[model samples]
Target: MTAAQARTGDKNCRVVQWATGNIGLRSLRAIIEHPKLSLAGLYVYSDAKAGCDAGELCGLPPVGVRATRSIDDILALKADCVLYMPQTIDVDDLCSLLESGSNVVTTRTEFHHPARLDRAVRERIEAACRRGGTSLHSTGSSPGFITEAMPLVLLSLQRRLDVLRIHEYADCSSRDSPEMIFNIMGFGQAPNPQAEAGRAWYLREEFGPSLRVIAEAVGLSFDSVESSGQVALARKRTTIAAGVVEAGTVAAMRTTVSGMRNGKPLMSFTANWFVSYDIDADWKLRGDGWQVEVEGDCPLDMHLHFTVPEARKAATTPGYTAHRAINAVRYVCAAAPGIRTSVELPQIVTDLSAQA
Candidate 1:
C-alpha cells in the first residue's frame, strides 16, 4: 500500500525524534509544542541522555517523554513518522527505520536526492520503502531550502531565467562539533590543493544531488556538475566554541557546485563558512544571512536575515533546519511511499500558536 493509502486513525500524528544533538533538541521542542503532533518517543545516542525527560534535554520543564538509546525501543513505538536528525549520515540506520514502517523526515542531505547515491544503496532504500510502504525526505537550511527550494520559488516570478546563484555565509565558530569542524570541514589543516580537492568532492557528495534536484524541478538540464573549493588561512590563533585554531591553519572555506549547461554555468550553489572573524579574506554577499541572485530578463537579488542575540547566532541555522523537517512531517506521512524531496511535498506551514 502507498503512504497516502495507509491509515492512522489517531487525531495527533505520533512522532519519534531520533537523536538529540543541536538539531534534534530543537526538533524535539518543536514536536512537543506543535498542536497536531505528539512526542511519542525520544531516541538518543549518548548513555548520559538516556532516561532523561525530553523537555529537560531542551532546557524546558519535564514533558514526561524519556530518552531511549535502543533502536528497538524506538521501532516498537506506534509512530506515524520519525524526525531523524543526527550529526552524521547513516544510511543503514535510516533504512532500518523505514523498513520497520515509519515515514521519516531528516536534515541529512545524503537522502535529499537518492538518485545521486550508489545504485546498490539507492536500491536498498527503495526496497525498504517498498517493503514497509514508507517515505523518507531529507532537507536542511543550506542544501535544503536555501539552495534548492528557495531559489526555485523566487525564479517562478520571472517570465524567463538565465542564471541562478545562491550564496551562504555562516560563522562556524559557534558550532560545537569538533569532528565536523576539523575532519569534515578541514578547518585547522594546512592548505593544499590536493586536500582542497578532496573537500570539494565531499561538497559534491553532499550537496550535488540537491543541485540536480533543483535543476530538474525547474525544467533545466545540466550536461555536467562541476565542483571547486578554496580555503582562507587564519591570520592569528583563534579560540571558539568548538576548539582552538592555530595561526596559519585553515580558518575559512568557500565551495561551489555548479551545474553546467551548454558549457556555461546554469546554476551555482556556493557556501562560505568561517570559524573566526579574522581570516586571510572576508567575503560577504549582503553582510550576513543567505543571498539568492538570479540573472535573466528581470534580474533579481534577495537577502534573508534572522535577528537573534549574538550568542545565539550559531543556533539559528540548526533551528531553521529542524523546523524545516518538523513542519513537513504531516506531508511526508501522507505522500507516496518512496524517497521524497521538498518538490513532492506540500507547502510547509509553521505552527506559530505555541511560539512566545
Candidate 2:
C-alpha cells in the first residue's frame, strides 16, 4: 500500500511527538491533557530518555506513551500526526516525515518563508505531503501569532495606516537551553550586521508576514520594501537567570522595516527584544487625520486578550505560539502545501471576537 494509504489505514490515531525540549514538552502535555487529542508516541533525540513515560517528563500522571530514540521506529508506529519541535536539525528530517504520510505541526522558523529554502527540501516536503494526502504547517510566536494575528486585528478600526510598527520583547534567559539565548540575541556576531545589509530576512519573514496582515486589512499593497536591524547592547549586573546567561554581553536587537506603497513609504514597523522583562506588540496609524497607538498590556493579554501572572508569562508564550502552529496543520493536511509567504497566508483572527 502507498504511504498515504498506510497512514490512514492505522486504526489508532497515534499523535507522535518529536523533540522533548520546552515546546515539545508543551505539545506533549497539550496533546495528552487535552480532551480532544490522544498521546500516541514520542520521539526524543537523546538515548537517556528512551523508554521513559512521556507524562513523567511533564510532571503529569502516566498516559502510556513512551519516549523513543529512533525516528525510524517512531515512523514504524504509523502515527496519524507528529508534533515536531526541533531547535536545530536537518530539514531532511522534516521532509522524511512528510513523505512518510504523517501530518505535521512544527515551531521551526523555516516555514515562515518556505520559498527561499533549499529547493530539494521544499519539493520533498511538498511531494510527500501531496502523495500522502497529509498536511504540513509552520507556525510559532513572533512569526506566527503576534506577527500574523495581532496586526490583522488592528485593521478592525478601519483607519488609514501611515506607519505600522510592531515592537516585541522576548526574554530568552527564561528559556531552558543555551541555544535559545543565541537564537534571540543573534550571538557570536558583530553588532547589527543584519541591519547594514538592509536584509534582515528573518525579521522580514516575521514583520513582513505581519505587515501583510495589516495590509490586507487596510486595503493596500506594497510594490517595494526596505528593512534594517541593529543589535542593542546593555550592561548586565548579574546573570539574566540562574543558568541561562552571564553578566556582560550584547543582549537584544532593534529591527525595523518600511513597507512602501507605489514607491512611497506608507507603513513602518520596529521590533525590539531585551534580556530584561518586557513583551508586547504595538502599532501606530493615521486615519481620519488622527494618529493612534495600539498597545497591549503585555504580549499575551494583547494577543490573546487575557492577563496572566508575570511569573507565569514566560510559560504562556510557547503555548500561544504552539496553538498557532497547531492551527496551521489543518490547512497543510488538505493537499495545499508550499513556501507560503505572508502574502500567501494573509492575516485573519479566529478567536478575538469570541473573547468579548
Candidate 3:
C-alpha cells in the first residue's frame, strides 16, 4: 500500500457498523460484501439484536461478527472508520469515536456545514479532531447528494448564476420503520398548529446549514436561510407500511428551506414526503426521487427517480442513503482532521469490482 493509503486504510478497510436500523442494516450488508472493506464489529441497541450474528440480520451466512450494544465495546475495536447511521446523533459518542482514532462518516445532517453549526458543538468536535487526528463527515441522500454534491457539478457549467431549486419527493408508504415514520416524522398524528410550527422550525435548523454551504460556494452572502412547513391530513383511513393513518390525521408533510439574499430567495430546497396520495390536500405528489432546476444564465433541469417496483421498495429504499455513506468511507478516512464537508472531500470514487 502507498503511504497515504496506509495512513487511511489498505484495500481491506476495517469498519464498525454503528446501528442496524433500516439504513444502517443496508450499510452493514454493503460493508460486508464490499470488496474493499471488512466488517470489524457491529453495534446494535436492543437485547434481541445484541447477540445475533451480523449475517443473520441481513440474510447472509454467518460472517462471525456479533452485534453489541455498548459504545465502549465499539471504541475498543481496531476500526479504521465507523459508519454511524443512528436515527439520533449523540455528540459525546461521536467525540469518543474520534478520540479513539477512528474516522467517522455519519448520515446525520448536523455537520454538513461546520461554520453554521452551534458554536459550542463545533468547538467540541474540532477539539476532538485535533486530539485524535481523525476526520468526521456527515452525508446522506437529501441534505447531502441533492443538497451539495449535484449542485456543485451543475454550477461549474455556469458563469453567471441566478437561482437553484431542489425538490425531494419520497413516497414513504413502503418504509417499515414504525418509529421513524410515526414518531419522528409525526405521521398518523393529529395536527396541533403549535407542534407543526415547531416541526417547521426544526426543519429549518436542520437544512439551513446546507444552504449556507451552497451560499459559501457561490460567493454569495445570505441575509439568512429561512424555512417554513405545511401539512396535509388524510381524507380517509389509509393503511401504510408502518400502520394506519385515520381520517383527519397527518398523512403528508412538506418542508422548505430557502437561502435569502436581500430578502429574496437565492437558493431553495423543498422536501415533499407523503405516506399516501389520498389526502385532504391536493399535493402534486411525484414518484420517490428528486428534481433539480437551475434557473440561471444556463438553465438546467433534471429528474432522478427510483424504478423499483413497489413490492421491493421497502427493502431497497435504504440503499439510497446508505450507499453514499458507504462510498464515502474512503474519502472521510483519508481527509484532514476536523469536520469534512462534502465540498471539502475528494470526489467519491467507488469500487464496483465485486459486482462482476
Candidate 4:
C-alpha cells in the first residue's frame, strides 16, 4: 500500500512532535493525553531540551519518548504524521519528512496556499509528496483560524461578494515575555529601516500566501498581493508587564496583507497588535481576539474574542493554535499526496471523546 493508504486511522495515529515551542509544547501534551494519538518521537532544537522526556517538557508525567536533536534519527523513526512547529520555516527538513514516508501537519504557515508560494519551492514540496505518497498540511490560529476557517463560513451566506476582510487584535499590555517584547518584537526600540524591512518581508513571504488562500477558496483571482504596515509610537514612557515602553519607541504595529484583484483588494488580512493603549497613534484596542467582516449579499460582521484570563494567557492561548493542527491529523493523513490547503480538506472535527 502507498504511504497515504498506510496512514493509520483515528484510533491509533502515531505522531511525532517537532520543536516544543509555545504551540508545539501544548501539542505534545495533547498528544500524550489524546486517546487516538500516540507520541512516537520528539524533536527539539536546544541541547538542553534534547535529552528530556516529551511529557516532562510539556509539564506532564514521562511518556517514555526522549527528545532528539538529529534529523536523521527522526527520518528513520516510523510516524504517521509530524507536527512541524518550529519558530521559522525549513523547507529542506519539511521536504525530507514528507519524502521519508511521514505525513506533516505544521503551524509554519508556509503551505497554506500552494499557488501563492514561489514556483520552485512549491514544486519541490509537491515532488516530495509524490515520491513518498504522503500528504502535508499547514495550519495555525491567526492565519488558519481567522484567515481561512472563520471567513470561509462568513462568506458562505453571500452570493454576490464585494469584499472580505479579517482583523486580528491583541492587547499585550499584560504579557510577561520580556525577551519577546523588547528583543524579538522591537517593542521599545526606535523605528528603523531594518524593522520596516523585516515586517515587509514577513508580509510578502509568510502571511501573503494566506490571504491568497482566502481568495482561492471564494473563486476570486488575485492580480497581486499588496503588503504594507505602519508603526505606532509611545507618547510617554510607561511600564507594562512585558517591559517599559520608552517615549517615541514602537508601541504598536499594524500590518495589512491584501489580495488585489484588478488593482483593488478583494480580500485582506490586517493585524492590529499593540503593547499599550498609550501610544501616540490612534489605534483601536479590542483586547486580545479577532474580528472578521464580509461585505457581500448577506453583509455580516462578527468578532471572536479570547476569554483567557491574564494569568493563564501564556498557558491557554497556545491551545487555540495547537489543537486545530492536532485535530487535523486524521483528515491530513487521509488526504491525497501533496500540500493540503484547508479548502481541500473536510471541516476539521475535534475528537474530544477521550476527554470524558
Assess each prediction's global lDDT (C-alpha) against the native: 0.83, 0.59, 0.87, 0.86
Task: Report the number of clashing residue pairs per model.
Answer: 0, 3, 0, 0
lDDT of 4 by residue, 306-328 (tens): 99988898889999999999988
Clashing pairs in 1: none
Better model by TM-score, 2 or 3? Answer: 3
lDDT tens digits, residue span 130-233, model 3: 89899999988878888888998998888877888999898888887799899988899988677677877887887788878877987887898788888999
lDDT of 1 by residue, 80-194 (tens): 8999988786778888899999999988888877777789988999898888899999887878988766877887887777998888877778778899898877888898898
Root-mean-square deviation of every model: 3.6, 7.9, 2.9, 3.0
Error of 4 at 59 (Å): 0.6
The best candidate in terms of lDDT: 3
Give candidate 1's TM-score: 0.88
Error of 4 at 285 (Å): 1.6
**TM-score for all models, in order of appearance:** 0.88, 0.70, 0.90, 0.93
Off by over 4 Å in 3: 1-10, 175-191, 233-249, 278-282
Where is model 2 poorest over a 10-residue stretch in terms of lDDT? 283-292
